[model samples]
Target: MKQFTISQEHISTYPNPIILKKGEEVYYGKEDTEFPNWIFCKSISTRKSGWVPKQILSTPNNSGIAKVTKDYSAHELTVNQGQTVFGIENLNEWTYCKTQNGEFGWIPSYCLSST
Candidate 1:
Protein backbone atom coordinates (compact mmCIF):
# COMPACT_ATOMS: atom_id res chain seq x y z
CA MET A 1 0.00 0.00 0.00
CA LYS A 2 1.17 3.53 -0.63
CA GLN A 3 1.69 5.74 2.38
CA PHE A 4 0.64 9.35 2.47
CA THR A 5 0.74 12.32 4.76
CA ILE A 6 -2.13 14.68 5.11
CA SER A 7 -0.98 18.00 3.84
CA GLN A 8 -4.16 19.80 4.79
CA GLU A 9 -6.89 19.30 7.31
CA HIS A 10 -10.14 17.84 6.01
CA ILE A 11 -13.49 17.55 7.71
CA SER A 12 -15.98 15.00 6.51
CA THR A 13 -19.21 16.58 5.36
CA TYR A 14 -21.55 13.63 5.13
CA PRO A 15 -22.15 11.67 8.30
CA ASN A 16 -24.37 9.15 6.63
CA PRO A 17 -22.91 8.46 3.26
CA ILE A 18 -24.59 7.11 0.20
CA ILE A 19 -23.70 3.46 -0.18
CA LEU A 20 -24.45 1.78 -3.46
CA LYS A 21 -24.04 -1.72 -4.76
CA LYS A 22 -22.88 -2.47 -8.22
CA GLY A 23 -25.63 -2.06 -10.79
CA GLU A 24 -27.69 0.07 -8.43
CA GLU A 25 -29.53 2.96 -10.01
CA VAL A 26 -29.41 6.57 -8.98
CA TYR A 27 -31.17 9.76 -10.00
CA TYR A 28 -28.54 12.16 -11.13
CA GLY A 29 -28.75 15.74 -9.99
CA LYS A 30 -26.09 18.33 -10.82
CA GLU A 31 -22.36 18.17 -11.08
CA ASP A 32 -20.45 19.93 -8.33
CA THR A 33 -19.05 23.17 -9.68
CA GLU A 34 -16.10 23.15 -7.31
CA PHE A 35 -15.40 19.46 -7.68
CA PRO A 36 -16.42 18.91 -11.24
CA ASN A 37 -15.68 15.22 -11.09
CA TRP A 38 -18.36 14.66 -8.49
CA ILE A 39 -22.09 14.76 -9.06
CA PHE A 40 -25.03 14.83 -6.69
CA CYS A 41 -27.11 11.67 -6.90
CA LYS A 42 -29.85 9.98 -4.95
CA SER A 43 -30.04 6.24 -4.69
CA ILE A 44 -33.12 4.84 -6.29
CA SER A 45 -33.52 2.10 -3.71
CA THR A 46 -32.50 3.94 -0.58
CA ARG A 47 -33.35 7.48 -1.61
CA LYS A 48 -30.17 8.59 0.13
CA SER A 49 -28.40 11.47 -1.52
CA GLY A 50 -24.77 12.53 -1.55
CA TRP A 51 -21.95 13.56 -3.77
CA VAL A 52 -20.75 10.62 -5.82
CA PRO A 53 -17.71 10.51 -7.98
CA LYS A 54 -18.60 10.65 -11.66
CA GLN A 55 -16.09 7.92 -12.44
CA ILE A 56 -18.29 5.31 -10.75
CA LEU A 57 -21.54 6.43 -12.37
CA SER A 58 -22.51 5.24 -15.78
CA THR A 59 -23.61 7.62 -18.48
CA PRO A 60 -26.94 9.28 -17.79
CA ASN A 61 -29.76 9.65 -20.25
CA ASN A 62 -31.99 12.67 -20.86
CA SER A 63 -33.85 11.95 -17.64
CA GLY A 64 -30.61 12.06 -15.66
CA ILE A 65 -30.64 8.56 -14.26
CA ALA A 66 -27.66 6.25 -14.27
CA LYS A 67 -26.44 2.97 -12.90
CA VAL A 68 -23.56 2.65 -10.56
CA THR A 69 -20.68 0.96 -12.35
CA LYS A 70 -19.19 -0.35 -9.13
CA ASP A 71 -19.86 -0.50 -5.44
CA TYR A 72 -19.24 2.88 -3.83
CA SER A 73 -19.49 4.69 -0.54
CA ALA A 74 -19.51 8.43 -0.31
CA HIS A 75 -17.57 8.39 2.92
CA GLU A 76 -14.98 10.97 3.75
CA LEU A 77 -12.40 10.86 6.48
CA THR A 78 -11.61 13.77 8.71
CA VAL A 79 -7.92 14.16 9.22
CA ASN A 80 -5.63 16.72 10.71
CA GLN A 81 -2.56 18.03 8.99
CA GLY A 82 0.49 15.74 9.11
CA GLN A 83 -1.59 12.65 9.85
CA THR A 84 -0.69 9.46 8.03
CA VAL A 85 -2.92 7.22 5.97
CA PHE A 86 -2.60 4.32 3.59
CA GLY A 87 -4.01 4.72 0.13
CA ILE A 88 -6.50 2.13 -1.00
CA GLU A 89 -7.74 3.64 -4.25
CA ASN A 90 -7.70 6.79 -6.29
CA LEU A 91 -10.78 8.06 -8.05
CA ASN A 92 -11.66 11.31 -9.67
CA GLU A 93 -9.35 13.69 -7.73
CA TRP A 94 -9.76 11.86 -4.40
CA THR A 95 -7.99 9.06 -2.64
CA TYR A 96 -9.60 6.29 -0.62
CA CYS A 97 -7.51 5.69 2.42
CA LYS A 98 -7.28 3.77 5.67
CA THR A 99 -6.10 5.66 8.68
CA GLN A 100 -4.06 4.26 11.56
CA ASN A 101 -7.18 3.73 13.63
CA GLY A 102 -8.62 1.52 10.87
CA GLU A 103 -11.09 4.12 9.65
CA PHE A 104 -11.42 4.29 5.90
CA GLY A 105 -12.75 7.06 3.69
CA TRP A 106 -11.95 9.41 0.85
CA ILE A 107 -9.80 12.51 0.98
CA PRO A 108 -9.10 15.01 -1.73
CA SER A 109 -5.87 14.18 -3.55
CA TYR A 110 -4.63 17.71 -3.16
CA CYS A 111 -4.61 17.29 0.63
CA LEU A 112 -2.31 14.30 0.57
CA SER A 113 1.37 13.94 -0.12
CA SER A 114 3.26 10.71 -0.81
CA THR A 115 5.22 9.75 2.24
Candidate 2:
Protein backbone atom coordinates (compact mmCIF):
# COMPACT_ATOMS: atom_id res chain seq x y z
CA MET A 1 0.00 0.00 0.00
CA LYS A 2 1.06 3.56 -0.77
CA GLN A 3 0.37 6.45 1.54
CA PHE A 4 -0.75 9.79 0.20
CA THR A 5 -1.82 13.14 1.53
CA ILE A 6 -4.80 14.88 0.07
CA SER A 7 -3.55 18.14 -1.37
CA GLN A 8 -6.96 19.38 -2.43
CA GLU A 9 -10.54 18.75 -1.40
CA HIS A 10 -12.55 16.36 -3.52
CA ILE A 11 -16.27 15.72 -3.37
CA SER A 12 -17.85 12.60 -4.81
CA THR A 13 -20.56 13.23 -7.33
CA TYR A 14 -21.98 9.75 -7.47
CA PRO A 15 -23.46 8.43 -4.26
CA ASN A 16 -24.66 5.06 -5.51
CA PRO A 17 -21.73 3.77 -7.51
CA ILE A 18 -21.76 1.12 -10.15
CA ILE A 19 -20.09 -2.10 -9.11
CA LEU A 20 -19.03 -4.42 -11.87
CA LYS A 21 -17.72 -7.97 -11.84
CA LYS A 22 -15.37 -9.57 -14.33
CA GLY A 23 -17.08 -10.83 -17.48
CA GLU A 24 -20.15 -8.73 -16.76
CA GLU A 25 -21.79 -6.98 -19.68
CA VAL A 26 -22.38 -3.24 -19.76
CA TYR A 27 -23.78 -0.65 -22.09
CA TYR A 28 -21.07 1.75 -23.14
CA GLY A 29 -21.82 5.41 -23.44
CA LYS A 30 -20.00 8.63 -24.20
CA GLU A 31 -16.52 9.32 -23.00
CA ASP A 32 -15.93 12.07 -20.49
CA THR A 33 -14.58 15.13 -22.28
CA GLU A 34 -12.99 16.54 -19.14
CA PHE A 35 -11.37 13.28 -18.08
CA PRO A 36 -9.67 11.32 -20.77
CA ASN A 37 -9.81 7.50 -20.66
CA TRP A 38 -12.99 7.49 -18.56
CA ILE A 39 -16.28 6.45 -20.06
CA PHE A 40 -19.85 6.33 -18.78
CA CYS A 41 -21.22 2.80 -18.58
CA LYS A 42 -24.47 1.21 -17.48
CA SER A 43 -24.32 -2.24 -15.96
CA ILE A 44 -26.59 -4.72 -17.66
CA SER A 45 -27.40 -6.65 -14.51
CA THR A 46 -28.17 -3.84 -12.10
CA ARG A 47 -28.89 -1.04 -14.55
CA LYS A 48 -26.66 1.26 -12.53
CA SER A 49 -24.44 3.73 -14.33
CA GLY A 50 -21.16 5.45 -13.51
CA TRP A 51 -17.86 6.52 -14.95
CA VAL A 52 -15.50 3.64 -15.48
CA PRO A 53 -11.89 3.55 -16.52
CA LYS A 54 -11.46 2.45 -20.11
CA GLN A 55 -8.63 0.11 -19.17
CA ILE A 56 -10.96 -2.31 -17.43
CA LEU A 57 -13.45 -2.56 -20.26
CA SER A 58 -13.17 -4.86 -23.22
CA THR A 59 -13.65 -3.57 -26.74
CA PRO A 60 -17.25 -2.70 -27.45
CA ASN A 61 -19.11 -3.98 -30.47
CA ASN A 62 -21.06 -1.77 -32.85
CA SER A 63 -24.06 -1.84 -30.56
CA GLY A 64 -22.02 -0.53 -27.61
CA ILE A 65 -22.08 -3.66 -25.49
CA ALA A 66 -18.84 -4.64 -23.79
CA LYS A 67 -17.53 -6.97 -21.09
CA VAL A 68 -15.77 -5.92 -17.96
CA THR A 69 -12.20 -7.21 -17.96
CA LYS A 70 -11.87 -6.86 -14.21
CA ASP A 71 -13.85 -6.29 -11.05
CA TYR A 72 -14.30 -2.61 -10.34
CA SER A 73 -16.21 -0.27 -8.06
CA ALA A 74 -16.95 3.24 -9.19
CA HIS A 75 -17.19 4.62 -5.67
CA GLU A 76 -15.57 8.00 -5.10
CA LEU A 77 -14.46 9.21 -1.72
CA THR A 78 -15.06 12.73 -0.55
CA VAL A 79 -11.72 13.92 0.75
CA ASN A 80 -10.55 17.07 2.34
CA GLN A 81 -7.18 18.76 2.10
CA GLY A 82 -4.58 17.60 4.60
CA GLN A 83 -6.22 14.19 5.02
CA THR A 84 -4.26 11.00 4.49
CA VAL A 85 -5.28 7.94 2.54
CA PHE A 86 -3.85 4.63 1.44
CA GLY A 87 -3.88 3.94 -2.26
CA ILE A 88 -5.15 0.51 -3.22
CA GLU A 89 -5.22 0.86 -7.01
CA ASN A 90 -4.34 3.40 -9.66
CA LEU A 91 -6.11 3.63 -12.97
CA ASN A 92 -6.75 6.33 -15.57
CA GLU A 93 -5.30 9.11 -13.43
CA TRP A 94 -7.46 8.14 -10.45
CA THR A 95 -6.46 6.34 -7.27
CA TYR A 96 -8.65 4.00 -5.29
CA CYS A 97 -7.99 4.87 -1.69
CA LYS A 98 -8.92 3.92 1.83
CA THR A 99 -9.38 6.63 4.42
CA GLN A 100 -8.40 6.48 8.04
CA ASN A 101 -12.06 6.16 8.93
CA GLY A 102 -12.31 2.95 6.90
CA GLU A 103 -14.00 4.54 3.90
CA PHE A 104 -12.82 3.47 0.47
CA GLY A 105 -13.28 5.19 -2.85
CA TRP A 106 -11.51 6.85 -5.78
CA ILE A 107 -9.82 10.21 -5.81
CA PRO A 108 -8.09 12.07 -8.61
CA SER A 109 -4.35 11.50 -8.61
CA TYR A 110 -3.67 15.20 -8.94
CA CYS A 111 -5.40 15.81 -5.61
CA LEU A 112 -2.96 13.58 -3.72
CA SER A 113 0.73 13.67 -2.92
CA SER A 114 3.02 10.93 -1.66
CA THR A 115 3.26 10.84 2.12
Candidate 3:
Protein backbone atom coordinates (compact mmCIF):
# COMPACT_ATOMS: atom_id res chain seq x y z
CA MET A 1 0.00 0.00 0.00
CA LYS A 2 1.14 3.52 -0.72
CA GLN A 3 1.61 6.02 2.08
CA PHE A 4 -0.99 8.80 2.32
CA THR A 5 -1.59 11.80 4.57
CA ILE A 6 -4.88 12.90 6.15
CA SER A 7 -5.93 15.91 8.20
CA GLN A 8 -8.43 16.32 11.02
CA GLU A 9 -8.54 20.08 11.54
CA HIS A 10 -11.39 20.68 9.07
CA ILE A 11 -13.52 17.71 10.01
CA SER A 12 -15.70 19.86 12.23
CA THR A 13 -16.53 22.30 9.46
CA TYR A 14 -17.86 19.87 6.91
CA PRO A 15 -21.59 19.54 6.47
CA ASN A 16 -20.99 16.03 7.67
CA PRO A 17 -18.83 14.78 10.48
CA ILE A 18 -15.85 14.42 8.13
CA ILE A 19 -13.87 17.22 6.49
CA LEU A 20 -11.58 16.49 3.59
CA LYS A 21 -8.53 18.71 3.01
CA LYS A 22 -7.36 20.14 -0.31
CA GLY A 23 -5.12 17.13 -1.11
CA GLU A 24 -5.66 14.09 0.98
CA GLU A 25 -6.95 10.54 0.43
CA VAL A 26 -9.03 8.32 2.67
CA TYR A 27 -11.26 5.23 2.55
CA TYR A 28 -14.98 5.75 3.22
CA GLY A 29 -17.47 3.02 4.04
CA LYS A 30 -19.35 1.49 6.89
CA GLU A 31 -19.98 -1.96 8.45
CA ASP A 32 -19.86 -5.05 6.16
CA THR A 33 -18.94 -2.81 3.26
CA GLU A 34 -15.68 -1.79 4.93
CA PHE A 35 -12.18 -1.61 3.44
CA PRO A 36 -10.27 -2.66 0.25
CA ASN A 37 -13.04 -2.31 -2.31
CA TRP A 38 -16.08 -0.06 -2.51
CA ILE A 39 -14.02 3.08 -1.93
CA PHE A 40 -15.06 6.54 -3.11
CA CYS A 41 -12.33 8.69 -4.71
CA LYS A 42 -12.37 12.32 -3.58
CA SER A 43 -10.28 15.49 -3.69
CA ILE A 44 -10.81 18.89 -2.06
CA SER A 45 -10.54 22.15 -3.96
CA THR A 46 -11.17 25.81 -3.07
CA ARG A 47 -14.58 25.80 -4.71
CA LYS A 48 -17.73 26.95 -2.99
CA SER A 49 -19.77 24.52 -0.90
CA GLY A 50 -23.50 24.46 -0.37
CA TRP A 51 -24.84 20.94 -0.93
CA VAL A 52 -23.50 17.42 -1.27
CA PRO A 53 -24.78 14.00 -0.25
CA LYS A 54 -27.01 14.09 2.79
CA GLN A 55 -25.54 10.78 3.84
CA ILE A 56 -22.11 12.41 3.96
CA LEU A 57 -23.39 15.12 6.31
CA SER A 58 -23.37 12.51 9.04
CA THR A 59 -20.48 10.31 7.91
CA PRO A 60 -18.01 12.94 6.74
CA ASN A 61 -14.37 12.08 6.11
CA ASN A 62 -11.54 14.56 6.49
CA SER A 63 -9.37 13.35 3.60
CA GLY A 64 -11.82 12.98 0.72
CA ILE A 65 -14.37 15.14 -1.01
CA ALA A 66 -17.96 14.41 -0.11
CA LYS A 67 -19.77 12.19 -2.58
CA VAL A 68 -22.31 13.66 -4.97
CA THR A 69 -25.74 12.33 -5.88
CA LYS A 70 -25.54 12.43 -9.64
CA ASP A 71 -25.26 9.74 -12.30
CA TYR A 72 -21.91 9.81 -14.14
CA SER A 73 -21.40 8.45 -17.64
CA ALA A 74 -18.35 8.72 -19.88
CA HIS A 75 -20.62 9.91 -22.67
CA GLU A 76 -22.17 12.44 -20.32
CA LEU A 77 -19.32 13.42 -17.99
CA THR A 78 -15.71 13.73 -19.12
CA VAL A 79 -13.93 12.20 -16.15
CA ASN A 80 -10.91 9.93 -16.07
CA GLN A 81 -9.45 7.93 -13.18
CA GLY A 82 -7.26 10.82 -11.99
CA GLN A 83 -9.20 13.90 -13.05
CA THR A 84 -10.30 16.46 -10.49
CA VAL A 85 -13.71 18.16 -10.46
CA PHE A 86 -13.31 21.94 -10.11
CA GLY A 87 -16.79 23.25 -10.75
CA ILE A 88 -18.82 21.65 -8.02
CA GLU A 89 -21.37 23.82 -6.23
CA ASN A 90 -24.07 23.56 -3.56
CA LEU A 91 -22.32 20.62 -1.88
CA ASN A 92 -24.25 20.47 1.36
CA GLU A 93 -27.01 18.02 0.37
CA TRP A 94 -27.51 15.49 -2.41
CA THR A 95 -27.31 17.37 -5.70
CA TYR A 96 -26.47 16.20 -9.22
CA CYS A 97 -23.90 18.14 -11.23
CA LYS A 98 -22.42 18.23 -14.73
CA THR A 99 -18.82 18.96 -15.53
CA GLN A 100 -17.78 22.34 -16.98
CA ASN A 101 -17.53 20.82 -20.47
CA GLY A 102 -21.08 19.40 -20.23
CA GLU A 103 -19.74 16.05 -21.38
CA PHE A 104 -20.26 14.47 -17.97
CA GLY A 105 -23.54 14.16 -16.12
CA TRP A 106 -24.47 13.68 -12.49
CA ILE A 107 -22.10 11.41 -10.58
CA PRO A 108 -23.66 9.14 -8.00
CA SER A 109 -22.07 9.24 -4.57
CA TYR A 110 -21.44 5.51 -4.34
CA CYS A 111 -19.33 5.29 -7.47
CA LEU A 112 -16.64 7.76 -6.23
CA SER A 113 -13.33 6.33 -5.05
CA SER A 114 -10.93 8.46 -2.97
CA THR A 115 -7.31 7.39 -2.74
TM-scores vs. true structure, each candidate: 0.93, 0.94, 0.21
Candidates ranked by TM-score: 2, 1, 3
Count backbone clashes in candidate 3: 30
Cα lDDT listed for each candidate: 0.93, 0.94, 0.32
Which candidate order results from sorting by lDDT in descending order? 2, 1, 3
Candidate 1 lDDT score relative to the true structure: 0.93
What is the C-alpha lDDT profile of model 1 across 1-115, one tens digit per residue?
A: 7999999999998999999999999998899998788999999999999999898888998888999999889899999999999999997788999999999899999999998
lDDT of 2 at 87: 98
Best by TM-score: 2
Worst 10 residues of 1 by lDDT: 28-37
Q: Which portions of model 2 miss their true places by more than 4 Å?
A: none
Residues 1-115, candidate 2: write the lDDT tens digits. Answer: 9999999999999999999999999999899988889999999999999999999899999999999998899999999999999999988889999999999899999999998
For candidate 2, the lDDT comes to 0.94
Best of the two (2, 3) by lDDT: 2
Q: Tens digits of per-residue lDDT for model 3 on 1-115?
A: 1111111111112322223432232333332233222234333442332222333323445754344334322122324444433334323221134434543233333333333
Query: Which scores higher on TM-score, 2 or 3?
Result: 2
Error of 2 at 61 (Å): 1.5
Name the lDDT value of residue 63 in candidate 2: 91
